[model samples]
Target: MPTIPSLSGLRGRNTRQPAVGRIPVPMSAYVVDCAVYVDGKRLPRRFTHADAIAEVRERGEGFVWIGLFEPDDEQIQGIAETFGLHELAVEDAVCAHQRPKLERYDETLFMVLKTVRYIEHESPTTANEIVETGEIMAFLGRDFVVTVRHGQHSGLHGLRGELEADPERLCSGPAAVLHAIADRIVDSYLAVTDAIEEDIDEIESMVFAPNSPIGAEHIYLMKREVLELRRSVTPLANPLRRLAEGYSPLVPDQVRSYFRDVDDHLTTVSERVGSFDELLTTLVDATLAKITLQQSTDMRKITSWAAIVAVPTMVVGVYGMNFDFMPELHWRFGYPLVMAMILVACLILYRTFRRNRWL
Candidate 1:
């Protein structure tokens, strides 16, 4: 397993501290948790970001992990200064709308990952949104890993606990932490894709069913949601591949193998998202064809009824003209004959339409 470099004798020379006498922003406001780990076990005492790194440097044998949630510029500035984070990276992290990517700044590797969740509702056909997204940014250094999360559902508290339970994996240092985070995120992508598959299946069944109430708008809405999901999952592929191919020294050879696994899972997700977009497009076309067929059927029925009504109207109109020379005006039998003829004509037309399946 990969491990971060030894922190011995580098305390004052390498570690950057926040400026002295600056008004302190309360760390607890945005900081989720901070701890020092030696040989994969977290220290029992809690520490602030500054204290955590300081403790690691003093001991010369451990690394610090700090997690923060949606910190504003002012709130995160101190941690950035202490960790020597690149200004551009810190700005991107604070802004919270970065594309998934990886960049190296001197010795620190900055990475952004988009997190997604499948929203549940009564039906996909009526739901306003199906996928919700968030962002997670990580700054990986020699002896510390800092995570900045930008959404409510993007919390890493559970992941932190899971890592703490497995000391051997956690012992691999900051790179290991980075790998675990990427693995967890890709797993989420798989789960969301599976759930969306179920929804697509439901929609497919409804679209083909006879007299289905499902509309094209519903399919369009789903397409929009799928597009949103695609945006989150697809762009991360190259970044993950880069990490797996040894793009940065911060990621060790052993950890790069783990990243390769993540990259494979991400590729699966990308394919699934692409397939979904295509299938939704088919559904839209199928729905339109069904609508056109229905309209044609309706028009045929209307034309058949109109033809039947025209017979009686023509017969009545002729008799009511009231010309003395008219054949039907003079004889009682003529009126009955004309009425019978109209009835027979209407029946003939009705049966003809029925035989052709127009009514």
Candidate 2:
């Protein structure tokens, strides 16, 4: 097995802290594999931007994968200029927070893919919910691959590791690299889907149980999450579909089938997202129904109490009228009798309510 740098140990000097004032990072590269099996001593040297173009021109046949993470805008422009990348594609890659998708620009193919990591944070509650956001952009050419992105993208890291581990895969060219990237990206979505579904299951249980612990705000936030997920992944389907159907010279004949497999994976993700959206809608409805029912139950109790108290209120009102001919007012047991009558009326109302199943 070919040895590649371990992701867990690849300590970037600048990664621990943000770069100052949007300065462009200088480019870097290292060789994972050098020579082809058939081409004996003919090995392509790994090089950075200006050198990469020169090296490609010299060799004129082998493939290359140049990945950039949180690169400076000027450096990105320089790479594009060196490789003759489309201006629009370069601009899109430089722009942050773009949805995942693939676009063809004449000879080159531009693909924007989401890279997600499940971040765990301390919480008062037992476990923390995942915090997710990352992106990877690839500009695929006939003989070279350029990937640019913001933040620490694990998907890209995995692809690099895979390439390093298996030299044969590196020789598989642009299409294989694209497939590796897509597979990792799809795996990210699967992770998110699993978390979301788990949340859904919790919400479902809460729906049936009276006085659920999960709050209304949490469910609404979850709905918003699913909506955002749909927004990010939906645009990606068409590009993957095109690649799967073998639309370009970049995607190899052997690997087009795998791209189709990736397309199916995204299709499954899309369908699940749709179903989750509906489940979220149902959760909202169920939450509202539970709240309404509880409120109605409370209101009935208050109204019933008020109705039973009305008799005592009426009796006091009549006694306070101070009419000399009133029979109860002149009796010795008048005050006690009035208290007794009020108590009796309360009991009678309580029994009536119990009989009617209104309590």
Candidate 3:
């Protein structure tokens, strides 16, 4: 095996110092971490993208893994050039919001995965957002794996540490890194799905409760969130399936089985997400039905009251005409008799309405 260059020697040769008056911007601003791994153990010294790949290729026994966070096109251009990443894939990685997918560009496999986090709130009925989404795009090569993240919560620092802790797994090469990333992403899906299920359950109970304050709008909001989740999750299924079935040479047979496991977990998440969407739809219908029933009940009560008032209104209207030959107008007990009749009629109507549960 060829001896790798010392870190100081490589840095001195490759790194350009800035002008004295100008403040230098380090690569760490966008390059989260860059390292070379030999036999699954991370090299102790840090390296730039160019240096890391050079070291890996020169040694011919290790691979380079580089991670970046929200890098612009200019910032990523050098790495793109160094790795021979396709232009389209580079563009998608720079300007994210691409759907979850897997594409092949010569010897490289580019895969995009959506990351989701559940926003916590007191109640689903009152929360404005239930699920928050992010993106992770991975470029897999025979001896290099590059990850670009596009959201605040989509950090992979912990994942890097976890992989480093398990050298046996990491030694499997760049495919191992790709598999770990996919596995971690699907595990996130599982967690977010569990949290969403709880929210759905809470909303379901509130929707069915007697005199519930829950509205269709709240359910609609949740449904909208679930729809967002679905969009992020559903499209990746085919990509994972293809990887499991060996769609790319970059992913070896061992990694393909792991991809299959990730695919199975993804399938579970997809099914749960689908069920959440359907349940939210049902809740919306139930909410609307309850609203309609409440409106109908209110109208019945209003109509019943109007009927009770009509009797006195009609009697008083006749007396108010001041006609000369109105019946009982001059009778000795006419006023009391009219009062009794009005009271009796109102009582009968009230009792009938009460009996019918319309009062």
Candidate 4:
């Protein structure tokens, strides 16, 4: 088991007055894991937050990786004090309603990444479940990396383990952690993009099916989800680019190249997202057009039937008047003749309508 830094005992030059507008944060037994690694290998002893800082300063080596899962304000405040985090960014992390963005404060870089999980469902429209979202905020200091994750499936425990296994890569310092995390997130963007594309294809097939009853509702539902995905993945491109271009001293020359690859991957994802938006809009229009055409066909059928029935109605209405001199009222064969005429008129009108496709 890894040790979490003892935040309460932290003192001296690193401490500062607590910022105002602080929420009464609950104490969470929520410390996920904390570890100190020097030269890409974990040390054998447990250390508190204060200890980790002291070790990094005294030894002049290694990096601290702290993971937290939805920590309350107090826990976050402790971590912030330990690392000297930006107040606004800390606020965003605590509240968990932030857009994907990056901000740098002096020697540290604060990044907010949105995480998403595709919800598998049979119907896109009525399913009420498609894309589930979460948030992960990373505060990258020269010798430390702290991550706060909110929502389910947002944990990076597996990622930390994987990075540890690849010491050669993790040797790049905290920037390596940043790259791995970005790679993981953008990889998810690709996964989500692919899943959404499949769903869109299904919707298109249903819309074009000869007698399918699919509606615009399904198309719009998918479009909405895609839009949300776009919002989550698009804004972070510039931040990634900056990292790859070596905007900070913390990101080493060796690690900078990896960010470029991540940026390229991001480019692809964002392009597909744009394409998905256009495709959905086209689908929506097509669906509405199909509905309108069907409605028109229905009205034509109804009108034609009414027209054919009017012939008999006219005859009946005329006969309904009790006029003594009406034609066909006196002859015994008159009744049969009038009935035949009515039948003949209806038959002719039906044929005409069928030929013209009105029926």
Model number with the top TM-score: 3
Highest lDDT: which candidate? 1
Candidate 1 on 1-359: residue-level lDDT in tens? 98776787575685887878967668887999999999999999979888999999998877999999999899989999999999999999999898899999999999999999999999998899999999999999999999999988988999999999999987888999999999999999999999999999999999999999999999999999899889898889998999999898888898999999999999999999999999999999999999999999999999999999999999888778878898756787987888899999999999999999999
Q: What's the TM-score of every candidate structure? A: 0.89, 0.84, 0.92, 0.90
Q: Count residue pairs with overlapping backbones in model 4.
A: 4
The lDDT per prediction is: 0.93, 0.73, 0.91, 0.88
Candidate achieving higher lDDT, 3 or 4: 3
TM-score: model 2 vs. ground truth: 0.84
Give lDDT tens digits, candidate 4, residues 1-359: 98876876574457776788856544335668888988898887887777887898889988998888888667788789878998888888889989888888888899999999999887765677688999999999999999889988888989989998888887888989989999999999999899888888888898889888788887887888988998998898998898888788888998889999999999999999999999999999999999999999999999999998999999999999999999879999999999999999999999999999997
List clash counts for every candidate, in order. 0, 0, 0, 4
lDDT of 2 by residue, 1-359 (tens): 97986877677644476656964444553222222211212244545556655665676766566777665557677778877899888888878688877788888999888766555433212343443667778888876778776766443665566666776766667777788888888877878788778767877887778667665666777777777788767778988888878788778778888888888888888888899989888878888888888888888888888889898999989888888999777789989988998999999999888787668
Tell me the tens digit of each residue's lDDT in model 3 across 1-359: 99987787786474676867845556789999999999889999979899999999899888999999999877899899999999999999999999999999999999999988889899887788888899999999989999999999999999999999999988889989888988998898899888888888988999889988889998899899999989998998999999889898888888899989998998998999999988998998999999999999999999999999999999999899989899999999999999999999999999999999999
Report RMSD for candidate 1: 13.7
RMSD of each: 13.7, 11.4, 11.4, 10.6
Model 1 pairs in collision: none
In candidate 4, the residue pairs with backbone N, CA or C atoms under 3 Å apart (3 or more residues apart, or in different chains) clash, namely 5-48, 5-49, 6-48, 6-49
TM-score of candidate 3 to 2 decimals: 0.92
